[model samples]
Target: MTEIAPIAKPDRNRPEPLWHQAEQALRGLIADGTWTDGMQIPNEERLSTMLGVSRITIRHALRNIEDSGLLRREHGRGTFVRSSTVIAGVRGLTSFTQEMAGLGLIVGSRILERDEQAASAEVASALEIRQGEPVVRLRRLRMGNDAPIGVQTAYMPLARVPGFLALEPSASLYQTLSAHFGIAPREAREVYRVGTVAAEDAALLGIETGSPAFVVERITSDAIGPFEFVHSIMRGDRYEIRSRLHI
Candidate 1:
């Protein structure tokens, strides 16, 4: 175990709260490599003594860091440092490839399962198509720098995209859709919620079962109509969804 030095005392004259100042100091340690990834951080008691603050303040600072995906807390074990989360913008209908590329990450995908199937009630509802309609189902493991980040399963009405099954496996389904059927996504709506990773998805993502994850349901439409429905399980520790609001 590496010894982490104590944080500097926050300026009492500043307007910043003690917890906020502690959080910034901790983050600086992470940024400067004082705390490396997967290294267990000092406990609240030790941190409080080092920073000359209360344990409550230390807890608040750790909570903020854990929420930001830079640290993960285990039930019995102490918090551990982790890589910074990958920020995904929620402004447009960008493909996974485009999103990863924007962050300077190498995007990759492994096709887990691909087959033509009848649309279920949920898929039909999302795609605005009749039940039992032919649909192409694709299950893929989305990767960043060859590390698994998410598991995505997409459904597309086969009636509209003929020969889609024959196309080569691709990291960007949007590009495949455009190249094969001249179908470009014009808009997309997504619903996000926090959830635990299931056994199957956890295995694929190389995380423990019941780990925190983000469940995203997306419905995308081209100029013609809704064409794709996607269900994604994104690793909460490795990804963060960001959105900007305009007044």
Candidate 2:
């Protein structure tokens, strides 16, 4: 276990709250690699004593840091520094496999369910298909470097891609679509929001229910028309979204 050095005492004359100062100090430790990933950090009592602050202040600081996705706290255990976030760029029309591969992480998928079903109202609207039309539904647990990172459910109109359900379980959906059907995603629009993990998805991602996560809803289209609708829940502690904009 790496011993965390005591933080400097926050000046009482400073306008910042003690808890805020403590949080910044801890963040600096993480940024400097003093606290590596998965290493247990000092407990609240020890931090309070070392920093000359109340235990309440230390607790508040730890909670804030944990919420910011830098720490994972376990009941009856201790807080551990989590891995750095995987940044997803908004400019790409890439699949999860492509994105993770670019970071040199091994990507794996476990198909939870796949079936041909009538499209629901939401799916139909997103794919620009008529309601009750046949669609191939795929639910998958997405893994990066052998660690579960997200759960994604995708719907595609059956008319657009026939025989999709016959593909191998572990094959990349995008690659299969491109190679067989010549359907490639040319553009995608995604909306991102924060939410607590639902029970089913939490189990699939191996996280506690109610853990913070990123909810991404995406609609993908080719030059012809919209064809795919996807909803994904990414682990907040392991992923972050990045976008570049030109002024």
**Top of the candidates by lDDT:** 1
- For model 1, state the Cα shift of residue 116 in Å: 0.7
Regions of candidate 2 where Cα sits further than 4 Å from its true position: 1-84, 244-247
Write one digit per residue (lDDT tens) for candidate 2, span 1-247.
Answer: 5776667876778999999998888888876778877899888888888888999999899887775556887888888987444567654788888877665456888989999999989999999989999999999988865678898999999999898888776548888888888998899998999998999898888889999999999999998899899999999878976555899
Local distance difference test scores for all models = 0.85, 0.84
Residue 177 lDDT (model 2): 88
Q: Give model 2's TM-score versus the native structure.
A: 0.67
Q: lDDT per residue, candidate 1, 85-171, as tens digits? A: 567665466998987776545688899999999999999999999999999999999887567899999999998889888888876
Model 2 residue 117 lDDT score: 96
